[model samples]
Target: MIIKPMIRSNMCINAHPIGCAKETENQINYVIAQKAKRGTKTLAEGGKAPRTVLVLGCSTGYGLASRITAAFEYGADTIGVSFEKQPTQVKGGTPGWYNNMAFDKAAEKAGLKTKTFNADAYSDECRAEVIKQLKDWGAKADLVIYSLASPVRTDPDTKVMYRSVIKPINQVYSGASLDMMTGKITQASTQPAEGDEIPNTVKVMGGEDWERWIKQLSEADVLADGCRTLAYSYIGPSLSHPIYRDGTIGEAKKDLEKRAHNIDAALKAKGGAAYVSVNKGLITRSSSVIPIITQYLGVLFKIMKKQGTHEGCIEQMERLFAERLYTADGKVPVDSENRIRMDDWEMDPKVQDEVNKVMPAVTEENVNELVDLDGIRHDFLIINGFDVDGVDYNKEVTDMSKIEY
Candidate 1:
């Protein structure tokens, strides 16, 4: 069946099998191109950079990119845990399902071992299964990457579904934002978190799950020596800070950062460390649903592209593994909060100065002239394997993907 992007609320509801394959191939090609970066090199030049990695939420976005980097670049054995919906003949599976399937196929060809678990990452059953797999492999991870983006989570014990909210915690926020779906600049306001909004947001997006993962991995003895973990976070410019950085989500991030310290201390005896990696804001599915951030992202993407600093999930992960997390000299540079700052280029004083000027000027009339909504849309599409080049969109996918969950 011919498939196209069916997007709503910043998410693509359907995916093309062939396009997803092509997208996965593209990322693998990128890893092959950057052979001298983080991947293994011949002993004559340097040496193999071998690792064992476990990635939670390793289906799409940064998690998928990180898996590719580990296996293709560093020749690492990897196990992935994610909550994803697979495709069927009646309907296209989530892009993540196809991506993960394609990744396993490619890894097999490359003689790399990869295992994926499609289940709620918050469930004890899933956690136990992942740990069991790690034990069987006897290749415990040297690094663990947390990139979960679920809106709600089910409590394993209580079976209660807790949904996360996106709201300012202190005051109602009004700002300029782009409608990624329509390419229209719209003014939006977000109300402050009330009642259980703050706590629920923390319960879902905070570092509790991450900390639990660490504890379980440690108890299971599935974490290799010097094993470190990192979770993704974001802190944008002042214009959107009230609804972003210093808002409800920001409170969760702060708690995550604080947990990093505790996790670090807990793992110190085993030579492990934990960190909150503050990343650049891109057109992620999660970010697209936020208030007043889409406009900033569109504008920022345009400026960053012009400045030769545009980066997507793959670029960001590549730099993180190659430079910040793993370097020839063995150093991990961090911000004052001890968080890894991959937003350096995006937050370049010059970039922020330009963004500040552009944020207030954005309006429906001036949206096109001021920002690159197309660029933002391109990002959102590419991440989901939609609108990809060299992929036949007209082909029937009834037999293309035999993926089942």
Candidate 2:
């Protein structure tokens, strides 16, 4: 059957099987090319790199890019955990399912060891299985990446599920929301969190799960000496703080950042380290739904592309490994806050000034001129395996359960 994107309220609810696989292969090919351009050597070549990596939330966005870079560029054996719906013959699954399948297939072709789990990362059973698999292989993870982006999470002990919200803190947040499909702009506003919403948001999106994963892995002795763990975060410009950095989600990020300190102290005893990498804002599944972000990213993308500093998920993860995480002198550079600032280019003074100048002037008439509407539309479509290059959407998907990468 031929598949097309079914989008509602800026969310793509359906995915294409072959398109997802092709996009995953595209990222792998990109990293392979960068290995030569950047002189990236694998551990087999006596280079400093991760030997065995574990990536939580490893299906899409930054997590998938991290896995691809670790396996393709650093030549690391990887175990990935993410919750995704599997496809059947009549219907397609989530984009992540096909992405994982493609990643596993490509890894096998490259002779890199890989195991992907379609299980919830928040459950204890999933943790136990990962630990058992690590023991079975007798491989300790040298790099652990936490990049989970879920709307709800169940507490492994209490059996209570908590859902996260994207609301402001104390005041009503009103911002311009851009419709990527139609180029229409509308005012979107959300009230402050009340009752258990703030804590619940924290419960779902905060650092508790991250801390638990690390503690369990350390106890099970599955973490290698001098191991490094990283979690991804984003802090856009002040314009987006009301709906992002200063919102309920911001409270969760602060908790995650705080836990990084405790985790860092514990890991330091083993010569290991922990950090919260403040990454750039990009068109992500979750980011697409947030207020003011779509418009902000539209303007940001236009200016950054003009400046020749635009980076998608793959490019960002590649630089994280080649420049920040693995330096030649064994020193990982960071900002004064003890965090790696990957959004440096996006937050540059000149870029923000340009964005500030252009955002207010954006209307239906000048929308295309002011923002990279086409660029963001392409990003939004490709994230769900639609509008990707070199893929014939008219072809039939003979089997939904499998893909040829």
Candidate 3:
């Protein structure tokens, strides 16, 4: 098999209107096909459909999945808030804005209302704008999903700069492989986490922002009664613990998990709830860049794929909505650690045991049998609609300045 070039661009950058639109259409079509395949009931009956939804960071990854869930499964009128940049036609354009446009087009076709706010969710001005828009629509959101991942955030009170980072927990001497051509992983080495990086990483990736979003929303009275909110997280196998769970990012996730309790208490007064779902590991743009984990992910994907239990962001989000979030009991289940155990299934003992046996011997020659590096990279490309079947990649994409929201 031939390896394609990997595209390394800015995260949370400008979006291409047409490409995003095509992506939105594609997701809607995929969801419709999936629903038909599963024969699940739509959320229309008994007035269970989400009437109003707010998705922060709705341009990519889990945020986009939540938006798709609202529109496709529950038939909700949605508002997506993101700091999406408008791409210049000269450079390779941004994808999120076009994705927004595409999603809007699908919503129109489905007879559901949709809007997008292209602004920083951390800014007071942007928050006010979203609140005003909600008031204008007279729609308090029944579900709010916070999925923002940024490097810097200002304290609402002190106005201090807080920069996020990813480091190991202990002194790590791990081996990692990279694809110099596409920046894709072909191999890697394993090691232990360093000590100092944990707190700093936790400070960055933890649940402070998530809690802040919920507090502001509740204060604004935009969260409807019985409202449910969720944030995405990940916990992989022991092989990845040093670089993942037991590492700096893991410490931050621990902070996030702790914040869930505070949020749950805050929302309980209003009959609302908050949850942090520890999702299965996949080749997200974010995950693919982490140390050592990339090769592990490639290997894990190969194992899970052979087992026929692999899932991407869409699959994870779809499951989170239908099975976890919108379930009949209205309670978000979690493990003893106060973390949802979504990844546990993916890293089952039997599965991990088998993968662990093969992990030590995995190299470029045997990687294909031990891991799904191709699949991982393929999903990464698909996030931007590259390698998507039936789509004309060379088509001249039109510029879309703004999405109405």
Each candidate's lDDT (Cα)? 0.82, 0.93, 0.70
lDDT per residue for candidate 1 within 76-171, as digits (tens), equals 888998877765567667778888898998898988888999998998888899889988877687888998888898877688888888898778
Output the better candidate (2/3) by TM-score: 2
Off by over 4 Å in 3: 1-20, 37-44, 178-200, 329-331, 394-405
What's the C-alpha lDDT at position 247 in model 1? Answer: 81
Segments of candidate 2 deviating more than 4 angstroms? none
Which 10-residue span in candidate 2 carries the lowest summed lDDT? 396-405
Error of 2 at 355 (Å): 0.7
Please tell me which predicted candidate would have the highest TM-score against the true structure: 2
Whichever of 2 and 3 has more lDDT, that candidate is 2
Summarize candidate 2's per-residue lDDT along 142-226 as a digit string, tens digits.
Answer: 9999999999999999999999999999999998889999999999988999989999999998999999999999999999999
- Deviation in angstroms for 229 in model 1? 0.9
